[model samples]
Target: MADKVRVAVLISGRGSNLLALAEHKRRDPDRPYEIVLVASNVPEARGVVLAKRLGLRTWSLSHKGMERRLFDQKLDTVLREHDVELIALAGYMRLLSPEFVERWEGRILNIHPSLLPLHKGLDTHRRALLAGDEYAGCSVHVVTADLDSGPVIAQTRVRILPRDDADSLAARVLEAEHELYPAALERYAHELRGAIGEGREGGSDD
Candidate 1:
């Protein structure tokens, strides 16, 4: 397998995670994998704009165009067209249809604000602050049909100061997301290359 991995990013809003990935790629010009596609349900998604700035291929599809299944089929086609080996979800607000989740399965990953399985959904930073927690964190994990219920790959922890508010905690957690997501993706790409190599060897030897 070639050294650089192919990655596709999916986003609905601000592409913080995508930006993080791009930053990582910039610092390591010799890395084997590079982002090949960026797709967003929102046509004006900032992530798509960011992708274009990075000179990577990008596309936008309206999520309201068809039944969920039809939409996923279109999405699947887009991903395939780009030769995407892995997918990362960044600021995507919609709940992915199960069909699409199953299509990618272990190949998909997402960064969630809270330390997942804890806050599970939105307002994570606020939730943590409201609960009077001393620490807040971000998580990168494999995507499954269950929302934010997949196996975690890595995480970064940030300490919440005594006088911290939601915004402050969120800012720190967002920083963690930046550091964590790219590292998680690198690991995922390395793992995929290994699996592919083994599969090819076994296939040829049979």
Candidate 2:
């Protein structure tokens, strides 16, 4: 079998989804990818601490004063150094520069708090509640140049209750995110691995 695809996860907050992904990988020995690095823009992020406890390699630097492109360039260097093949964004608050997005292209995925094409930016849960929607959900999608405008890989919907507020709906959506993200990544990685195999096998030696 081919070696597992190398993945890096970026987080800015508690990294609940990161933990879920790590736990899923640990539980399933045959997963198609391995999270080789967990990185964060916040040097003191809790996710960094959690990654350490999980015995995963980590990289972190404060993005406060740095310019966007410059920070992304430095981050790109670290990712390349780790030979990362895929990137998963879990609560990563910063917007990636367009250049950086083009560099990785379809190789990156992000978990959004709401079903995309509906709520593209922040305050998604609140907006859903205000609109009196019947359901709110989380989506895992490929990262593109446009914000939250990527092709969705998968989604998990949480039904909105009669008394649901933004916070309550957010919490339920978060739980769904934890479940959806790991499973989505697992399947996507498997597809990527198969594509690589097909390419190599179909190459002609001229």
Candidate 3:
């Protein structure tokens, strides 16, 4: 496991995707990453509870009164303490400050519950239904300062059914997210490790 990338998953609610990723790691010994930490702003977040149940190291602090960067700084401290190499934003509701994004640029990934570039912000399933779109899906992408506007790594599309409401569509899309995220994260970790290796090996000796 020395070669595995240390990953930290950030969440603000029930951690369905967190469970999915953890299960994938548990079942796949060859995964190129390991879950090192699970942290949240809400002290009672169900995700934090689930992480503890899964025997993962966990941290939580209420973000109610703290400034965005201040809260993120504390969170960053915990992540650094765990030597986190990659961050997966799984239903993490807070908008990260530009400073935080810069600190982990190209190292954060998020799974947005829309095809993305289609539904950028919240209420995506409802918006997709309202827009009369033919499909709704989830996307795994790089986390940029812009909300849900990062470069997509992979996506899974669910057909928008005629009888679907927001809740129905959301339920199906969430299922897609569970399947899409773990696979995308594993792929991204491998590619990132390879890219770093290439950069190091190809560096000029000055």
Candidate 4:
């Protein structure tokens, strides 16, 4: 763990993407960052149970009762408690407010199911199929309050076959996410750590 980085992950449902991230982290134990935190806005998010089973720290600050300000404050506290250096949003459902976004600006990253600036919101799989997109893909970007408007870090695309439907396209995009997200995180970590030495390489942070 000499060059290890600290990563905290957020999710709102089954942490399939988080699980993938965890698996990738495990694959390279010598690499920077571990899945140090698994948090959910939903109390019953199955991922929390899974994380606990794996003996990882888990938290649920349910969104039902608290206001956004309070909720985000609680989230910030938890993130700080874990000494998180990077924040990854896997299946987190809500839009992060400007305050929270600014608090962790440039340190937050998210994975989206489609090549962004196209389908910015939900139902990307169905929308891509209905719109007859020639290709569907996934994007890994820095997080911003303007939804997926953050600077692009990396992306990978897959052809939309004539026979492809929402479910089929969703599966393919997920595979792309699994591949792209980890690579993007690795590059990001390496560049960040390299900079801590003397800011020698990597493109300017957007």
TM-score of each: 0.94, 0.96, 0.95, 0.91
Model 2 lDDT tens row, 1-206:
45788999999999899999999999987899999999999979999999999999999999998999999999999999999989999999999999999999989999999987788899999999888888899999999999999999999889999999889889999999989999999999998888777887888999
Q: List the residue pairs that clash in candidate 4.
A: 4-32, 5-32, 5-33
Per-residue alpha-carbon lDDT of model 1 for 145-181, expressed as tens digits?
9889999999877898998889988988898899888
Instruction: State the number of backbone clashes in model 2.
Output: 0
Return the top candidate by TM-score: 2
lDDT of 1 at 132: 82
By summed lDDT, the worst window of 10 consecutive residues in model 3 runs over: 192-201
Residues 48-87 of candidate 4 have per-residue lDDT tens digits of: 8888887788988789877898899999999999988789
What's model 2's TM-score? 0.96
| Model 3, position 56: C-alpha lDDT score | 96
Model 1: CA > 4 A from native: 1-3, 204-206
List, in order, the clash count of every candidate structure.
Answer: 5, 0, 0, 3
In angstroms, the error of model 3 at 185 is 0.1
> Cα miss at 166, model 1 (Å)?
1.5
Model 4: residues with Cα > 4 Å off, grouped in runs: 1-3, 196-206
